[model samples]
Target: MFKNRYLYIFLHIIMWLGYTALPVLNAIQRDTSKPQTNPYTNPYYWAYVSFSSILLFYLHSEYLFPKVYKQKPIRYFILLILVIAILLVGRYSARINFVGNDINQTLFYINSFIQYLYIFGISASYSFFTDYQKQQSTKRDNEHERLKSELSFLRSQISPHFMFNLLNSLVALNRKKSNLVEPVLLKMSDLLRYMLYEKDDKQISLDNEVKYLQNYIDLQKLRFGDYVDIDFNVKVPTFSKNIEPMLLIPFVENAFKHGVGMIEKPIIRVELQTIENQLLFIVTNKFSNDVQEIKDGASGIGLTNVKRRLELLYPEQHSLKVQQKDNFYTTELKLNLRQVA
Candidate 1:
């Protein structure tokens, strides 16, 4: 506002003109027809009220407000009292010199000081209000930046976590000298491509994400080679809904990592379906007491990272339940999805 010089001057002129017109409006409202009893009939009365008000407001808003903001109340009060005293004298002289009859100095000074102080109060309130708005805007900006940073950090963690688990899968093939390494590497390339290209997106089509999951499952099937029974079911009415990328991988990965080794007739079940913009995913697997969740101190990151991402991205819009019962581990996720336009 201050940078626009013409607008600033125009607004101040309009405001002060309205201020000067107030006494005349008041006199007209009171039916002050006799010039002897009418203060508005005198041109000096306009100066007395309008000039003092504008000067006092400017002084308070510009100089006195800075003093108060800087915690210099003593100097502000002293300078304010001096300015009001001088304006009061000017008001008294205007009344005496113009009307010149039955002039009570005390009452006139008192009323004029009250009016000046009211303008000062108004200026102070304006300063505080503008300052409060700025503070709230700054606070909101800082909060947005913090959330963005946290989500970025969370996204950065996914690539390494995924690479680590995938390397273990490939290592198993190497140890066995299996011919499946070639297909697994090709599938891994596809997964890595999607992960690399789509990691920066806030959301992605549920169709593409589901395809990524299918590729991962296929790779896993190649690695295990019929040793583990994996049932993956997916049902969706449409493919236009959007989901956070990499949000659903952890549970299925967790099942494969902790459910397969050292167990007879190992089984893993994954169910994904969407019902009118709501997504439900369930992963259940058979596990033994000996096949604990901890493996190389990193089996926990998958679930833990997904949980934190769910909280940050979905907030109150999702439900996740993880439990183990009857030697079976299960994780259920219900997410509210965004439909495409």
Candidate 2:
């Protein structure tokens, strides 16, 4: 409520000034044939009224309005009428008894009621507006926190899925006693370090993301060696840009996960190109009809996670297309880099 302290203070000053000046101005405008008995001349009367008004304003605003009215409106209205009546009676009785003034009882009651009404209206309106704004702010904060948690869970899914596949490759190399095991472990170490440390950031240098993808591709190359045909190409201009970490790797991993083993003469093609403030990523692979679709467990979870992340993070800034025709599965992603965070 006090986010803009100066504005809050300014508005409060203006309200109080108006509250103090209006009744005095009205008294000056009225016919005062008996100048000696003019109520405006009595500073004590004005002080009592001002103090009582401020007290009632805060009572209704800070306590009664929200806790009582919002929960039980009928009860609140009943209590408000009772409070107003008591205050009016008290003020009229005090004025007649203590002041020793011949003031009209009915007129005093009417004027007192009107003044308290004005105070109640002003305080209630201000309280309601500020409360509504606070509720909206709280709602936005909760949504932001939920998004962060969901993104964390999705990224968590990707790391373990990638690691499980790499570990499987390592096991295969160990059984075959392949000489490329050392290099594969080195590449895996770099990939793991990058994922563990750098992936926590909302954005990473486009250069680093490309290098991570290259490391994964090289590891896959060692795993397959001469058995499968692979074509990986990246063409990025000498420019500086940031991309969501691990955003593009799912498509490449999906290609390798479902595009080999069961298939004869398997082929995987991954290409990335950047033109100005736009990026294009395409991954295509050949699959065997005998193999199940990549919609089970780890494969399905990875794809779903990335798709949701893209929707949340990029929304209108990116487009994705996945198509399977005959034995080939292809995924094409286009992203607008201008809105990168």
- lDDT scores for all predictions? 0.86, 0.84
Q: What is the TM-score of each candidate against the true structure?
A: 0.82, 0.80
Model 2, span 48-124: residue lDDT tens:
67767887888888878988999999998998888888778767766765465687778888888988999999988
Instruction: Report how far off residue 24 is in candidate 1 (Å).
Output: 3.8
Measured with C-alpha atoms, the lDDT of residue 55 in candidate 2 is 75
lDDT of 2 at 332: 96
Candidate 1 residue-wise lDDT, 1-341, digit = tens: 56788896898799878878878778777875664477776777766778788888888887777656369878878888888899988888787788675767778778888888889888889778767887899999999799888888888889999999999899998787578889899999999999999867469999989999999999998988789998899999899999999999988898998889899889999999999989999999999997545457765888888898888889999998889999899999999999876
**Candidate number with greatest lDDT:** 1
Cand. 2 TM to true fold = 0.80
